[model samples]
Structures are given as C-alpha cells and as structure tokens.
Target: MKFRKATKKDVQAIVEMIADDALGKTRENFQTPLPKAYYNAFENINNDNNQELIIVENENAEIIGTLQLSFIQYLTYKGGIRAQIEAVRIKRDKRGTGLGTKMFEWAIKRAKERSAHVLQLTTDKKRPEAIVFYEKLGFVASHEGMKMHFS
Candidate 1:
C-alpha cells in the first residue's frame, strides 16, 4: 500500500468509503449528483498549508483508505502546536488488516515532523471497538468531549 496526499480525483472514493460505515450512512450522502459541499470542503483543506487530506491506495492504484490531519497553532500548552486527526475511514474490506494502525503511525510521524507538541482526535462514543483500537495505539480517554450541531 502507498500513502499520499489526496487529490480532487480521490474525493469521490473517499466519500464512498466514508458513507459505507453505519453512522456515516445517516450523515453522509454519496450518491448521484453527489454533494457540492464535499468538494467545497476538499478545496478548503487542499488550499490550507496547516491541513492535509491523505489517501491510501493499493498496488492496483485503488483507493483503500483516507484521513485528514490538521496542525493548529495555539497560545496554550506553552505556545505549542497541536495536530488534530479526523475523518479517518478505511474501506470495509480493509479493516482488521493493520491498515488503520499504519495510518496512525504515518500521522504521528508527520505530526512530529511538523513540530506538533500534541496529537489528538475524537471518535464517536458509539464505536466501542474504535475506542479500544485507539487505546491500543496509546491514546487515552483523558477528557470529555462535547459538541453541538447547528443543523
């Protein structure tokens, strides 16, 4: 497998992978006509120097996974910078194959190279398995995370 920065052409595959999941089915729309919002968001991410949308492909050049990493400059934590990882999705068939682990490893390395003092992510509480998976990767449930959806 090879990991690379995602291009506009990869967005469709990434959206499909995202929509393949249970929760995503309720929140994501990856159908005919697709959504302009996805492309709009992709463009914003692509143009930002502090953010990256990554794509993972196999030997046949089929996209198998994707994730986004963002570096945030902050005044707290001794003026440290932090890396926030999100939108991690692997093709259903690619799960349990250490691909997610490999993705995290790559994210960590990239975060360190960017001089980030911390790496963080928030997973849905409904995904118990994901919590375990992240715990195994050295992430701790140190604080409660909350969000409010305007929609």
Candidate 2:
C-alpha cells in the first residue's frame, strides 16, 4: 500500500471510510449524517504543516484507509511537543490485512519528523477491539480521557 497526504478530491472517500465502520454503524452517535463543516476543516488542516492528514491506497490506487495527526506544542513541559492521532479508519473490507498497521507506522514517522515527544489518541470504551489494537501498537492507558458533550 502507498500513503500520501489527502487532497480535497479525497474528501468523499474519507467520509465514506469514516462513516462506514466494519461494525456496520457510523462511529459518531449523532443521528444526523456527517456535516459539510467537518469536511471543510480538513481544507484548513491540509494547508497547515502542523496538521497532517494521510490516506492509504492499494496497488490499484484505491483509497482504503485514512488518518490524521495533529501536532501540539506546550510550554508547561518546557516546550514539549505531542502528536495526537484522530479519525483513523479503514474500509470495511480492508481490516485485519495489515493496512491499519501500515497507516499507523506512517503516522509515527510523520510524528518523528515533526519532532513530537509523544503520540496519543483516545478510543471509545465500547470498542474493546480498538483498545486492544492500540495496546498492540504499544500505547498504554496512562490517563482517563474525558469529554463534555454540549448537546
């Protein structure tokens, strides 16, 4: 598989991969379909060197997976840097074929290139398989992730 930064032309494919999980349900709990605003954000991110969004394509050049890496610089840790992975998804038929691992490895390299001190992400507790997959990738549950929903 080959990986490259996502272009505007890849938005529809990204939406499809994200909205159609292997479990047959869209990962977001909201009833409404994915919004255009969400995708527009990618436009700004794609232009920023600090934010990277990548897509994985097979030998035939068909997009099969996507992931985003956001770099954060902090002063509290004396100028520490971190990369957070988000929206990692593989097309339903592409799971367990090592594509996910390849995407992650690419993200890791991007993080290192950006001089990030750590890489992190959060997965829903309901997705036990995802938690195990993160663990297998050498991630540890170091903190209790929290969220405050407005709606």
Candidate 3:
C-alpha cells in the first residue's frame, strides 16, 4: 500500500469512491466527464500549500482510497495549526478490511510531520459507524458541531 498526493487524473476515482455511499448519493454529482466544479475545487486545493488531497494505492497501483487534509491556521489555541481531515472514502470492495484504520494512522503521522498542533475531523451524525470507528481510534466527541449549508 502506498499513500501519495493525488493528481488530476485521480479525481474520477476519488469521486467514484466518495459518491459510492448512502449520504454521498444525495450530495455528490458523480458522472462520466464530471462537472467542472470538481476540477475547479481540485485546482484550488492543489494550489493551496495548506491543503493536501491524498490517494492510496495498492501494490498494483490501483487507487482504492482518498481523503483531503486541510491545515487551518487560527488564533484560537494561541496561534496553532489544526490539520482537518475530510472526505475520506475507501472503495466499496475495500471497506471493513482494516485499511481505514491504517489510512487514518498515516494521516495522523502526516499531521505530525506538518507540525500541526492538533488533528480534527467532522463526520455526519448520520454515520454512526464512522463515529464509532473514530472513537475507537482515540477521538473524543468533545464539542457539538453545527453547520449551515447554502443552496
């Protein structure tokens, strides 16, 4: 297994995995010749030094997982850098194979390498299993998260 920064060619695979879930079915517009918005977002993320779009490949070099990490600089924590993980997705066939745990462990190590003071992530309350998995990995539900989505 190998974890590396994603390139433009990897977007389709990333989106495929991300859109393969119940919640994703509602929010993601995954299709052949994907919408330009996806590419735009990828370009923005790729150009940002604080952002990392990661892809995981198996021994055969097939993309099986993806996640985005954002380094946020804020005054809160006395000017600290918080590494936020989001959009984690593993191919349906690869779920429940311990790859998720290893991917997260790699993310934690990557955060430390980037000199982040803390690592954080938010999963939808509807994903109970994900919450449990995160908890098992030593994450605590310390604060209530609220979001306002715009149409």
Candidate 4:
C-alpha cells in the first residue's frame, strides 16, 4: 500500500469512497463529482498549514482509503496543538484486512511529528465496532461531544 496527500486528480476516487460510506451507514454526505461548493474544502486543505487529507492506494494504483487530519491551535495551550482525525473510510472489500489500523497509525505518527499535544477523533455512538477499534488504538472517551445538524 502507498500513502500520499490528495490532489485534484484523486477527487473522483475520494468522492466515491466518501459516497460509499454514506450509503453504508456513514454520515458524511459526499457525492461523486461532488458539488462545486465542495471544492472549497479541497482547495483550502492545500493552503491550510493545519490541515491534511491523505489517500491510500493499492499496488494497482487504485485509491482504497482516505482520512483527514486537522490541527487546532489555541492561545491557552501555548505551544500545544490538537490534531483531529476525521472522515476515515476504507473501501468495502478492503474492510477487515487491517487497512484501517495502518491508516490510523499513519495519522498518529504524522500528528506526533508536528508536536501535537493530543490526537483525537469522533465516531458516531451508533457504531459499536468502530468504538471498539478506536479503543484498541488507545483512544479513550475523556469528554462528551455534541453536534447540532443543520437540516
């Protein structure tokens, strides 16, 4: 497997992966050839020093997974930074083959390299399996997180 920062060329595969997750009980609303407005996020990711989107590929050069890391800097924390991992998804057939673990490990390493004080991610409470996976990776539920969906 190979890992690389996402480029415009990767948009299609990324969109497909995102959409597949949405269809298979994931909450993200990504669509193929994503609406023009969504380009802002992709463009901003490249320009933002605190954000990264990575894509994983197979030997055949097909994209198989993706995840995002966003660094949050704050005044009270001084030198500390928070790396928030998000949107992690692997293709359906690739599930249960340890790809998820590798993807998460890579994100953790990258966060550490940037001197982040904490690496955190949020998973839907409904996904018990994912909660277990995160716990296996050393993540603990230290706080409650809430979201208000704008419908």
Candidate 5:
C-alpha cells in the first residue's frame, strides 16, 4: 500500500469511504460530483502545513483509505505539539487487510518525525468496534470527552 497526501482529485474516493459508515452517512453528503464545500475544505487543509489529508492506495493506485491528521501547537505541556487523528475510514472492501494498522503506524511515525509530544483522537462511542480497534493500538481512555453540536 502507498500512503500519500491527498490531491484534489482524491476527494471523491475519500468521501465515499467516509460516507459508507452509518454515522458518516448522516453527516456527509457524498454524491456524484460531491458538494463544492468538500473541495473548499480540502483546499484549506492543503494550504496549512500542519494539516494533512492522507490517502492510502493499493497496488493499482486505487484509493483504499483516508484520514486527516492535524498537528496542534498549544501552551500546555510547555508548548508541546499534539497530533490529532480524525475522519479515518477504510474502503468497505479493504477492511481487515492490515491497511488500517499500517495507516496508524505511518501516522505515529509522522507525529514523532514532527516532534509532537502526544498523539490523540476522539471516536464516537456508538462505534464500539472502533473503540476496541483503537485500544489495540495502545490508546488509553484517560480523559472524558464532551461535545456540543449546534445542530
């Protein structure tokens, strides 16, 4: 598998994988010629050095997974950098192929390469299997996460 930063052309494949999940289907409007907002957001991320919208491709160069990794700098931990992973999704037919694990390994190495002090992520509680998968990656539930949606 090849891991690389996503180009504008990869947006549709990335969005498709995201919307394949139950929760994502509700919030993501994935369709033919996807909403312009998705491309706009991708543009913003592409311009930011600290943000990476990643894509994983197979031997045929077909997109098989996607994720967004953000490097956040803050005052806490003495000006530490934190790597946050979000919006992870593997193509429906590509799961269980070790692609997911390989992606994280890449992300972890990337965080270290960037000198990030910690790597973090937040997964919806409704996805129990996801929680377990994350645990297997050595992440601990050390803090309670809270969120408020305007909608």
Candidate 6:
C-alpha cells in the first residue's frame, strides 16, 4: 500500500469509502451527482497547511483508505502542539488486512515529526471495536467528549 496527501481528485473515492459503512450510509450523501459540499470541504482542507487529508492506495492505484490530521498549536501543556486524527476510514474489503494499523502508525510518526506533544482522536462510542483497536494502539479514554451538532 502507498500513502500520500490527498488531492481534489481523490475526494470522490474517499467519500465513497466513507459512505460504504453502515453508519456512514446513514449520514453521508453519496448519491448520483455528488454534493458540492464535499468538494468545498476538500478545497478548504487542501488549502490549510495545518491540516492534511491523506489517502492510502493499493499497488493497483485504487484508493482504499483515508484519514485527516490537523495540527493545532495551543497555549496549554506548556504551549505544546497537538495532532488531531479524524475521519479515519478504510474500505470495507480492506479492513482486516493490517492497513488500519499501518495507517495509525504512519499518523503517529507524522505527528511526532511535527513535534506534536500529543496525538488524539475521538471515535463514536457506538463503535466498540474501533475503541478496542485504538486502545491497542496506545490511546486511552482519558476524558469525556461531547459534541452538539448544529445541522
């Protein structure tokens, strides 16, 4: 598998992978004539130096996994920077093949290279398996996370 920063052209494939899962099928709108919001968001992420949308592809050049990393410089923790991992998704067919582990490993490496003091991510509580996977990767449930959606 190969990993690279995502381009605008990769947005569709990434969205499709995201929508393939049960939860995503309920939330993502991957219908005929894709939504402009996806492209708009992609452009926004691509323009931000602190944010990265990554794509992982197989030898066949098919995009099979994706994730986003955002580096935030904050005043807390002795003015340390934190790397936030988000939108981690892998194609359903590719889930059990060690690709997810590799992806997290890569993210951790990148975060350390960026001099981030911490790497963190929030997974939906509904995905118990994902929580276990993250714990295996050395993440802890240290704090409660709450969000209020406005849409």
Give the CA lDDT, 0 to 100, for residue 16 in model 4. 70
Ranking by TM-score: 3, 5, 1, 6, 4, 2
146 Cα displacement, candidate 4 (Å): 1.2
Clashing pairs in 4: none
lDDT of 1: 0.94
Residue-level lDDT of model 2, residues 48-106, one tens digit each, is: 87888888899999999999899999985679899999989998898989888888888
By summed lDDT, which 10 consecutive residues of candidate 3 come out lowest? 72-81
TM-score of each: 0.97, 0.88, 0.98, 0.89, 0.98, 0.97
Q: Candidate 6 clashing pairs?
A: none
List runs of model 4 lying over 4 Å from the truth. 22-32
* Rank list by lDDT: 3, 5, 6, 1, 4, 2
After superposition, the stretches of candidate 3 with alpha carbons farther than 4 Å from their true spots are none
* Model 5 alpha-carbon drift over 4 Å, by segment: none
Model 2, residue 147: displacement in angstroms? 0.6
The per-model lDDT (C-alpha) reads 0.94, 0.84, 0.95, 0.86, 0.94, 0.94
What's the true lDDT of residue 149 in model 6?
A: 98
How much does candidate 5 score in TM-score? Answer: 0.98
For candidate 4, lDDT tens digit of each residue in 36-59? 755777898878888898999999
Worst window of 10 by summed lDDT in candidate 1: 29-38
- Indicate the residue-level lDDT of 151 in model 4: 68
Determine the C-alpha RMSD for candidate 5 after optimal superposition of all C-alphas.
0.7
